[model samples]
Target chain A: MVTESDTGSIQVEIIPSRFLLPATAQKLLNEIYGNGGIIRIMIHGPNLPRSVPYGPGRGSPIDENRDLLIEVGGQAFELSVKVGRIRLELESEKYYEGLKAACERALPISFQIRRGKFFHTRQTITDYAKYGKVEDTRILGLIDPKAKQDRLAILSEENVAVHDEER
Target chain B: MAYTPQYYPGSTSVGINRRKHMSGNLEKLRDIPEADVVAVMGHRAPGADYSSTHPPLKEMGEPDCPIRQIVAPTAGAAAGDRVRYSQWTDSMYFAPSIPYWRSYWGAINCKGCDPGTLSGRQIIEARERDIEAYTKAQYDSEMTDVALCSMRGCTVHGHSLRLEENGMQFDMLARTEMGSDGNVYAVKDQVGIPLDRKINLGKPMSEAEAKKRTTIFRVDGIPMCGKVGARKYDEAVDALHHMWELRSKWGFRPE
Candidate 1:
């Protein structure tokens, strides 16, 4: 979800457990911010809570989906993504391939992919101001940069073994 | 260290590894007039404490540039040998504590001779001074800040008519001179390239004395020592206008 404050401040949250995959969340973030600004990602799980900030500078506490606030030129922006089965409030927007490239730059591979699947696979994103919306929904699938080549190969290789399973 | 391969299109590597070949190319650049801007470049020599880093080169033309390059002597180069350098090492490199090798490029400056006879150092310095004066004249007249384009064709915003405040700043007030002819002529004194702004003269010039008549025009308020051509004043005016527009867009301080 994206929310803009009165002071030109912005807040975005993406929960992976609530989505099909992390890639879904990534796709949504990429669609909003084109470029010209920096994006920082903080990963928090079972054990790592309020841990040290990743990357260059030191001395900071960050938690998972708690809130990572970024301020630029006196304005603030925050992003938090929740995990596990979620009913996306916004309509699922069609995923763009370039979105994958953008995600690769910001969040790590694992979280980015999970977010992408969760958001793009299940939600419905609509233009509130304009009813004539852009259709961006795509087939249910996972697009992970790290697993792209291997996953495509696995899918193409006559999946005779998995076909035998009777669910 | 292992010998790395160096590649140059249609050019022989002189059978040396990448490091040596790079040094050779850098040497050749020192000789090219266009490459005179490369005052320093080199690979880190083995065990030679090569931690120094040269900052990105400033685009050539600007008024009152923090960086200046003249064919100045290197610590090792002979008195006649010249190298390009900034006015201050600290402003050029983010960190200047580390030691590094040096190189020189560009023309030399020689005073005393008429403007037309100048080619090497004298010509380069004259051009720089003339350009600076031109910008200053415009600033003084328009009462605004102007942009100064570097010799490298990069434009820097922020140049003003007001004198800069430095404890030891010299006065370079603008003035007008009238000679035998009755018309008033504007003139400015020349400022030498700073100690850090040194570049070596790439090619030697024939020191021939030519019988040439020259005129002078003041640019901005800075005094320039040069023989002005028929259209030199117009050219100076155009340069100032271009810089003026640029500085305005870049939010330069007029002060």
Candidate 2:
């Protein structure tokens, strides 16, 4: 807060309040993380499969192209985007408001935003614990993207490095 | 007694198209060369011999039956050409030749043909040369829009999917690709095997042209409910309703 400056000149301030759709969000993310590595963006919506399910060409391969090969910040990132509901396990409630708003701008229907306990705030009795899981279901994917146990393996599998540079 | 044939009922553009398709009155849109049609069918090379499944009926010397004597075999059967099929997939986005409509066209127009209709695709199986001729007729007719309808024997995925930016229907196997010269080129056969050279199928129909020619009663287009003679209370619907009611009532009666 710029309360009282020594010069006491007419102080001007700017606030970033523009709502972002998927296209705009993509640009914003690219600009913010342009210098290096990867800023994780988990896109959730209508999960369209990359293959045909029925008819004469049943089980035939298709290029759904939902798995986007986006070249952001001059670095190509293959975002394995899925469409679904997200249960936020956020430390701050304010961040959840922004996440909900972002979802609204993209998908206006079939999405419910509510405060709930879902993903673990603290890692314990994990789906896939330090070594491995007792029963790792295939539906949840072979490796959970959120799990910390196979953090390094997940990064390598997705071909992305953690964005750890100072702002 | 002489009989008059009325194809389909309705005063709407869509109904009119259905009538045109069924009556074999669809205007010729393009003339794909016989060689090009063969190339797309991928059954046999252009000018190649038509492989046979059996000897010609005359050569085999069939047993003298009154029925066989009266019913002359088609040219294809007479030549002993093997039975072959042509399958087509029409996109739901105002494609002219819907599955059922395609089958109707083939069943009524093509002789010695067996038409099978699926949800998104339709196939017509006949003697090899006969099928090729039938397929070529459909390809050249207004029933097929190069972008909206495609000959896809298998792996047909674009029936309900969004069209590509170039206005071509989505082909999972990339059977067709749009050329820089504004012509749609078929690079692969119906089953998706790469061809030796591209077959230029010509330009896609304009949005206006497709909407006018489409037989599909879409909400944005000439919806069936809003059409002048095809409305719910229209004679076509009323006739169908009356027939259904009578059929059910008569089922329980001896008369």
Candidate 3:
């Protein structure tokens, strides 16, 4: 019942929930980059809850904030997260290795990772109607407004760097 | 001559695991320090002298009874230690131990033990020291995985609930937490009281290890009736059937 035109490139995060915290993800990224390597981190998970449903804390706000401050190697990078998979395609083999290690550490042991095309690699009609522009890369198809506003700045490897030593 | 005892039947991994638990012969996988176990139990503080309800049995002269003289009391009973309990909730998602099996394990292996089996949780009541020892055995043995099982006196959710996105069971009272180092740390007692410091419970089981050690038979993992010899050779089922057929004919007055 599904058609190709209706689909877009997307990612599936098969890992458990605890590892998606910005701080924890940053720690994992730091570990991979610590050993003379350059890599980009892609985070994938369920949609962050927007509200608290019941009890004395009923209707309280959940993780509604789309922006997070990710700290890796003492450096702080402001990342605007969407409700879906955040992909990383970079210029080094270490990036893949780091991504694998981080995922293994973060996800449950029973989950599996598959290699394939998941996200829309091309701009859609929606993008043209909404943004009045076509994205050059396929990774940014179904992103949040904040992520779009940032214009791929958050995904830039230049945003990641070790913090100044004198902290 | 004594006959060899067989604990359970079926060639499936779940059946084997059940036998190992009933037999009390599974190897201990990790060591949670004694004080840590005590802290989590919340009956008494670590190193605190057990509060007694009665004087020592030796000090309190007892009326002569033949059964009392013939059978020995457990260490806690002997010491006149107060009765205490440690309750555990196991995630049905491939947890190494389940409620009914835990009850069976305690009844067969522990002295002066009274194990309560519920739908989602198991509770064992024994004299202070005896229950502590039994609790430690369950915690350290292959029966428990830090992420899949938790000590909860109340608010024992996550049994049927899908594992928290991290595959860990978060005790409702916030008794346990997954540490940044990826190990489980118990910061609260079983009853939701906070401890002075956290106790490290150690690493969780791998997926393969958990599947092999689990007693829960599932279609995705190892189906209960799907195994080669399980349906045909299940000794427990056979025994139950034999009892059931006779019971229908004989009623309660088997004699």
Candidate 4:
């Protein structure tokens, strides 16, 4: 269960002008993760299906841009979507500057940083129906509730230590 | 008194480009070989004879009618060619041509053709040979920016999506890919069937060139409702508004 103090975390969304390649996304993630002020991060984009979903090419293999692996903070995971927008939950308002700097260092194209409520603060009815009594509120909207496998990739110990120290 | 047809109304570059497309006065940008175009189309093998639906008009005597006599049969129609279709998905991010404009181009320029315009993609159906000629014309002209437009026969889902970092439009089937040599290539047919060899589609236009050539009125480039800083409807909008007003009035009372 998340305490009342955790509800005050600042949320920021980074929307790039173009969908980033897996390597570019990894670079961006590494840069941002290195900054140490982020509590949680979620990458969002259009899904790259494993097979041709419909039409005459249905069931055909689509290898390009699908099943890509990206490492962030020493943890690697398969990227299902082409990275377009990245939403972050920061410990405080002070971390916004660091986040902006990280984006600048990694991105070659223009991007927009918007500060607002982008994630669910608490579990909803749908979350209850899908997840069945979620314990960690931070993981509330990180992934699709009906996803077969957990998409969350926990970073290394040092990164978790930094998050723990901030708390 | 004589009146010239004003294809589209606006002082902006977008309007001018639209007019050029509708008038079939597009500048030839590349010379993709007919065989390569045919391969990308995936209808038949290169150098193969066109399959026909019916006997040639010369052999199958037509009814002696004034309409039939006045309209001379096109090459494909005279040869009794099969009706075939070609579809294109143009990126919304400053693609040279949009679905509506493509339909307009087909309607105004092509003979014995049917053009369909959807939200994301546009398609033209004509006799097999005629469609091939039309497809080649579009591929060779400024109407198609290879990176921003693609030949998608089915599962057309990339028009409104953000482009890849390399600037190529998002294609779910991976029909086309940008080669390391800086030119785009079609590795697969329009329907996602792998081609025997990659066909070079020439270099993509620069961002500035695409913006200048694009018929879409975008907020970042040229806004349909207003300029960059100013707030005034473009001449195209005004013309459309006038037409709508007259249409509504006529609809109420057909005099």
Candidate 5:
């Protein structure tokens, strides 16, 4: 039951895969859940690969200096970012060459993973036959660090890939 | 016994005698009673001797100030349909001498010689001074006062219509009673001017009678009252004439 004291208990689902920029995703997050609280969950898109850095790479070193964990409303939450390159690395890349190739070809998409259960849910992008148009409300929430490659894959699959190569 | 006939020279029964035989005329005038004169003139005539020979009406019909015609019924008509003749004229005067006399004698004459001792220039100056004083006094007296027409100057037999200067504008004061038709008609003046003309009492007198009186009141191609700028003096006089003609249809004759 939601009460006046449950003000801080409110959670926001950020669909990072939907928004174009990180700032746009953050703005939508601020609008829905306000600015002061912790963003509890992120539902990463299925097409996005999951990968992390294993060995020391040739390129610039990752700055893991910043605290990845943020405290909100007395609750400790883990911050996870979805990168398309990380997703590609999870599926195929085993060495520095694969990582570099993934970095070049793959788009970065991230989502916050916390407590095993999915708080953010995905809405289906149906064919134009069942629904004439898609409404913004159908997009339940945006995932942080939107998945660009996943969107490309979805557009190509729908056969509505009009401005692909240049865009 | 035979009675002797007494005869006064240059005497006639009509009572008009030469001015020279004044004493004889006086005695004869005394013998005739005041009532006899009234009886001869007629019982309806005004008690005053306001005959055509009177100074005011004497020159009335002359070219100088042409006589005004009567457009209403004469005084001899029925009770509800009679017209009476009444008129008054204003005479203005100028008295220039009073101020000049006072100033000249008070200032200059007191310091100087008598009449015989004065020089030619002094005489001319004195005469000029007197003339100036007289002319100014006359002008002042002329402009100072005006004779107003009022109910006091009116007669019971006829309604009185007065035209007086109201500030800078001229207006008419009409005093009258209701007619047989229950509509009040202004008493037409001796000069045929109606009191207030807005009522359309002169032409096409009423809605029903309009067709009959239209020809009489229409002048210069317009009905007198409806004419443009009818409030102007000449237009007003024309309108008054129109009203007079309407009243005359009822047969009121001016004396």
Candidate 6:
């Protein structure tokens, strides 16, 4: 288990003026991942439900802006929410300027980068109840514990090298 | 003395816009075809006959009463048309009209109608023909911007959410899409039913235009309590405060 003092990572949140499309999100993610100082990143937005959740059109298929596929750092994942805010844990405060520069290059609209403790440093009772005996502390509060599928997409040099060799 | 109605009180643009809406004196922004409006409403097919609920008022023959003799029936009521409804969801981002203002407009202008206002949506129910007329007027007037305000019967979400990258409101069903031709089009009806053909809603107004025309008060545009440099309550707020004070005082002791 990695303690908070051991890592000494800093958290920052990137908030855009508007929600991003899948293509735009992919571009932003690639830019941030390429910069190579991010320890972990969490995307936040409103859920794009697969079917109509309520009202007269209940259970109807909603094809638009749902189940979008985005590739970042050669890892493709299905995005279920509209990209609104991106919270990143950096190795140190030195990478904050680089992160802002990355956002500037990827986003056409105005954005704000706020420095704060955005992520939960330690697991709570709910996390323990949902995910019994967590082994990886880095992913403590990265995702919704109740979600059936794991939303994490690990991007490492070794994994990329293996993917490139296979290709 | 002839009594003149003052719709609202304020010197800000929002107050002016509210007065314009309440007085039914909005500028016509677009001319969406009658058939297209009908298609988006999804209540009945375009050019189809309006179904009736009862016999014509003249034929039905009301009882001999003073109120009945004085009040004339509306066109739809006279024709014995069934009651129908239209609903709208307006974005929080400087939408031309909000739910409360829309309800106010309906109460002031329309006859024999029920206007319901919710946090994110507003609905009006009236006789079939009258509702169609009201819907068409709202679509064509400056009260609605196609990108920021949309007709939504069910699953009415996205009013308080952030807008899409293209400046359009975030609709989960995506009933409307911005076409490559720089015009908005309705591919699906208000209830998420796919339309037989796309209905072209005119181009959306620019950000500056929407801000100028909107009734909502925002810190970025114009705050309800004046701007940062000059912090003061608007005239409308003062009026409301006066009314509230009188109401509370009267309720506590009626003399």
Give the whole-model CA lDDT for all candidates, comma-separated. 0.24, 0.66, 0.69, 0.88, 0.25, 0.87
- Assess every candidate by TM-score: 0.15, 0.68, 0.61, 0.89, 0.13, 0.90
Task: Give candidate 6's error at residue B63 in angstroms.
Answer: 2.6
Which of the two, 1 or 5, has more TM-score? 1
What lDDT does model 4 reach? 0.88
So what's the TM-score on candidate 2?
Answer: 0.68
Model 1 lDDT per residue over A1-167, tens place:
98633332122233331222234333434443453221222222122124333321122333222454533233344423222222222222233334445545544323333332232434222221121222332211222222221222121222322221232
What DockQ does predicted model 4 obtain? 0.54
lDDT of 5 by residue, B1-255 (tens): 897323212122111111111222121111213332222212123244322212333333434332223333222221121122112221111111112222332233222112211110111112222322322221122111112111112221111111111200011222222345543333432222222231212111222222221112234333334445645433335545777889878766677
In the range B1-255, model 4's lDDT, one tens digit per residue, is 899688999888998899999999999999999999999999999999999999999999898999999998888999999998999999999999999999999999999999999999999999999999999999999999999999999879899999999999998788999999999999888888778899999999999999999999987898876566557767888998999999888858655
* DockQ of candidate 3 relative to the true structure: 0.05
Model 2's DockQ score: 0.08
Candidate 2 per-residue C-alpha lDDT over A48-162 given as tens digits, one digit per residue, 9 for 90 to 100: 3455444444554444334455554565655432222222223233344444444455432333445432333233444434434333221132235554432222322444432
Which prediction has more favorable DockQ, 2 or 4?
4
Model 4 Cα lDDT, one tens digit per residue, A1-167:
85545436798999999999889999999998888778788888887777777766677777785669888777778998789899989988777888899999999999999998888878787666655666667766776656533466555353321122221
Model 3, TM vs. native: 0.61
Scored against the true structure, residue B15 in model 1 reaches a CA lDDT of: 15
Tens-digit per-residue lDDT, B57-107, candidate 3: 999999999999998998899899999999999988899999999998999
* Higher-scoring candidate on lDDT, 2 or 3: 3
Task: State the DockQ of every prediction.
Answer: 0.00, 0.08, 0.05, 0.54, 0.00, 0.54
> Could you tell me the lDDT of residue B17 within candidate 4?
93
CA RMSD (A), model 1: 26.2
Q: What does candidate 1's lDDT look like per residue over B46-157, in tens digits?
A: 1343222232133223345443345432322222222222211101111101011111111112221122111111112222223233222211221111111111111111
- Show the colliding residue pairs in model 6: none
Task: Indicate the residue-level lDDT of B115 in model 4.
Answer: 100
The TM-score obtained for chain B by all candidates, in the order given, is 0.17, 0.92, 0.92, 0.96, 0.16, 0.95
